[model samples]
Target: MFTNYHEAIEWIHSRLAFGVKPGLERMKWLMNRLGNPEQSIKAVHVAGTNGKGSTIAFTRSVLQEAGYSVGTFTSPFILTFNERISVNGAPIEDEEWLSLVNEIKPFVDELDQTELGAATEFEIITACAFAYFAHVHQVDFVLLETGLGGRLDSTNIAVPILTAITSIGHDHMAILGDTLEQIAAEKAGIIKEGIPMITAVHQPEALAVIQNTAKEKNAECISLHDTCSFDEQQPTETGERFTLRTSKRQYPQLETGLIGTHQRQNASLAVLLIEWLEQEGYISVTEEQIYEGIRQAVWAGRFEKVKDHPPVYLDGAHNEEGIDRLIETVQAHFFSKKVHICFSALKDKPYKKMIQKLEAVSSSIHFVSFDFPRAESAEKLYVCSHLDAKSYDDDPRTVLEFIQKKSDDPSAVILVTGSLYFISDIRNRMIG
Candidate 1:
């Protein structure tokens, strides 16, 4: 058994060699061995190509504001692994993490001895989240965000009270399928029989897929546009404020720490989910509580400004859609400011297209590579980008220094974008 947090993390990472196996069979067995912890806790299962994390953050904050004990499980840790699982905004303590890992290690070993096969790294982490929520934290509601495509993601095993799809787009296309319809079908797999679903997908093909899936499962699917429409988004000193017009309500000047127009849609979805919960008599939360929750919710690494002087910001725009949103927000807010970009991306991403979008707006672009196995090196990206005058550095910190040095004007803005893994490393070095 692992005796400490470091050992636990080491053991978990050791299973990475097994890679991703997209199926719920192993997870089902693990949960059963752990007394079906997932069935014991109330949960809101969330999935989508983007905005799932922000939506979960908004819902979790609102629930907390309503005096409900909330547990959250998310992925691609922007800061630390502990942030991936939290209760009331505080991450799992080291002692709690070690204790839980020790308790579950034996069960995992027993699974290894059988024909069912050992759990993947994500599955083990997911099992730990279930055990923590159901047995340790005993939360009133748990926000479970799928680690990958909803159909076979590790977190899809939860028996949630409701499910939400933030937005459908092209991401993980290889695993989820190449076409929009195919990806939408994979995402729609989270809809459970008789459960309610909410989605922000407006794309016709994607919406039709989700509708059909929910219909087949006898789930009540509610599109955000059918219930509410967002408008009047204006960036503020802290974040942004927007208005939501629902069928039965008008939420004006809703504020949130998460920026970008897409955030308004996400926050609106959270509002709709809460109202649906109230209608079903599952949870009672006041409108005022929700307003405060959306305002107070802090989703780091999504266009987050971690520094003021010289104006350094970090965003997780790993995919094309995310990059588009990031670009729109940057243009809307920082157009007057001289923008210098420090970015990196995974080798698998359409970096050429993303870099082109950034280059159109930035005064200069600097690419930096982190330690992620699939990360595209800055040197290779520089030659491939064909940016005749842009800078390249293997070390992210040096890239940051270069951007700061180049942008010396008072209105200069130093921005960081690219893979979430790269952003995680940059955030740790710059802020931690």
Candidate 2:
């Protein structure tokens, strides 16, 4: 049994060596032994290449406003391990977390004796979240975010009432597959028989895959294009205000604190999910409640401005599509200002493509490496770049400090992005 919170977290993170094992057999066995805590609560499974976290955040907030306790599970924590599993916007308490770990450790030890492979880090975390939410907190709804691909992610062990695919893009290609259709199939794996699924995927190939899967499973899949027509009225510095028109409801105005036009799509997906939850009598929710939830939602480290006076912003745009949105959002808001980017990426990421996209908005690029096994070094990243504005830094904070010290103009914008892991390091430093 772990004596302290930090020790518990360190022990859990130490299991990263097991890596991501495809398939849910280990997860299923673990859950079965633990009395199936997932079955104790109504769940909504969310999967996609991007926007999954933001969508989870939006859904959680709205459910709280609708007078129901909501439990959220999302990956790549911005601050602490507790943030990965939260209820009503509060991270799991260290005491409670240690207790859960102590309870589950016996099951994990038992599994190690069997022929079944050891549970991965994410699997244990998933179990912890399920046990905490269902048995301890007793949340009304659990919104689950797939850690990796939907098909075999640890979180996929849940039989959700509803499922959502925010968007299908090229991410985890080695595991999920290289093409859009293949990735979509992996994402669509969360859909179950007779369940109602919602999606904001617009890619023709990806949409076809999801539609076909939904058809086969008898899941009533709703697309944003078919069910609710939406148009972005405008983008704001704080967030975005959009217009959404659904079959039963007309929200002339919808607002969210999350940045980027892509966020409107994620928020809209959350609205649709809430609407379905209400219509199906699963959870009673009003449009006003949904609007309020969207308005108050705050997701950290994605184009999040944590400082001013030579403005510093952080975005966790690890994949190509995510980096594209990061560039777009930066250009949309900071085009008038002189922009400098402090970028880092995991070795597996398509940093070349992400860098290519940044050429349009950035005046200079400072490549910085974070502390991660797979993190791409600044020296290597600098060598590959053809951009005239490229440089490298071993210590990421030095780049931020340099930007602040050198920039006399208040309009100068400094963006630190590329990897969520990098943003995690940056955020902890800023908060301290």
Q: How many collisions between residues are there in candidate 2?
A: 0
**Residue-wise lDDT of candidate 2 within 1-432, one digit each (tens)?**
889878877878877888888888888998898889888889999999999999998988898988888888988899887888888888989999889888888888888788987877888999999888878998888888999888888888898999999998888899999899999999999999999899999998899999999999999989987787877567787888889888778887788888887888888888889888888888887778888999988899977888877778888988989987887777677668888888889999888888878777878888889888999989988876777977788787776576766469776788888889899998888775
Which portions of model 1 miss their true places by more than 4 Å?
none
The C-alpha TM-scores of every prediction are: 0.97, 0.97
- Name the regions of candidate 2 deviating beyond 4 angstroms: none
Q: Each model's C-alpha lDDT? A: 0.87, 0.86
What is the Cα root-mean-square deviation between model 2 and the actual structure?
1.3
Q: Candidate 2, after superposition: displacement of residue 17 in Å?
A: 1.7
Worst 10 residues of 2 by lDDT: 398-407
